[model samples]
Structure formats: structure tokens, C-alpha cells
Target: MQKQETTRIKKEDKVKIIAGKDRGKIGKVIRVDKKKKRLLVEKANMIKRHVKPSAKNPQGGIIEGEGPIHWSNVMLICSSCVKPARIRMNILDSGEKVRVCSKCNENIDSK
Candidate 1:
């Protein structure tokens, strides 16, 4: 199936995990992968990875890092409401588009 190229959750957006083991976790969006429909939330959904010793590192060990979570598993937190909320898109009279929070009707995106 073709994935949507644009996502409501953009870089630097605060989001709350709504499902899976990381449910209820809140974190900022570190990255957005539209092609894979996944988002890497900072300090959330952490996973351990084993890395081999390289020239940069004298020892190989396991490290914990944030893992990418599905877009569907997270909900954008409305700045106005300070809680997980849905997004609504609308155009202004000036012909500019804005993302609005469904719960508070506040413009979520400044740009």
C-alpha cells in the first residue's frame, strides 16, 4: 500500500503514546519517517542494542536508545489543552493553512 507522505506529527511536536508497551508515555518527536509511517519519539520506547567494538570504541556493549514507534500508536498532545488530542486542518481567510486541535480549537502549528 502507498503510504501518506505528510504526517500530522512533525519534528519537535510533543506526542503521547496511546498504545503498546509505551502507552501513556510523553515525548518530543525526534524524527518522522513518512515512508515507513513511523516516528522516533525522544526518550520513549527505548530499546537496547548491542554494538561491536570499533576503532572509535575500545569496548563493545549494549546501549539503550529510543526506538521508532508506529504513527498510529501516538497521539499529538495539544499545547492548549496539554493533553492528547486529535488534529483538524483548516484554511484561514488569508489563504494560509493551519493545524488545529480538536479538543480546544487552538492552532497547534505556528507555521
Candidate 2:
């Protein structure tokens, strides 16, 4: 079995696209695929899906939505600084690991 890769980014985290067609775009991470090292960001990497007619949709047609982008293409946006910043894993005295913003040196995880 393939092991899941560790990622600094998490679901619901705001991120800025650094590389790709959506470069410089900022959006919230909707999902994280650790194994694929991809992220589904809100309003980024828009894609069109041709949906067939089904009970869920009476008139299925082209649906536009966010598509998965490579994790390396995005940078975490630091809440404290309100900018896309690098992150470092820090182990607290309580033995809990937390993500710290490289620019502001603030905890990324909310209390």
C-alpha cells in the first residue's frame, strides 16, 4: 500500500497559487489529496465538466468548478501577516506539533 505523504497545508487553509495558470490567485483549500500531493482550492484552477443527465440534475450540462492543483504550486497564506508565507513545523512544549508562519512567526493553527 502506498503511504500518504505529509503536507504542511490543510483543509480550509487559505493559499496562494505560485505556479500554474492560476498563479497569484488566492483561495481556500477545499480538499487535500496527500497521496497525490494535490489541493482543491476554491475558485482556482477552474475546469469544465460535462455531466450527463441524471436524477440529480434534470438538465446536465457543462459545469464549471475548481480543479486539483499540485501542492507545490501554492503557498500558505499567513493569517497574522495576511501574505503568502513559508511554513515551518514547530513542536510545542506540550508535545503538540504546529505550523508556524515564516514571516510573522505566528501559529497557523487556531486555538
Clash count list over all predictions: 0, 0
Model 2 poorest ten-residue lDDT run: 1-10
- Model 2 residue 67 lDDT? 94
Clashing pairs in 2: none
Q: Which residue runs of candidate 2 sit more than 4 Å off their true CA positions? A: 1-5
Q: Which parts of model 1 are misplaced by more than 4 Å? A: 1-6
lDDT for each residue of candidate 1 in 1-111, tens digit (9 for 90 to 100): 545455788899999999989899999999999899999999999999999988776697887899999998999999888989988888999999899999989999863
Best by lDDT: 2
Candidate 1, run of 10 with poorest lDDT:
1-10
Candidate 2 residues 1-111, lDDT tens each?
A: 433356789999999999989999999999999888999999999999999989988799988999999888899999899999988889999999999999999998964
The residue pairs in collision within model 1 are none
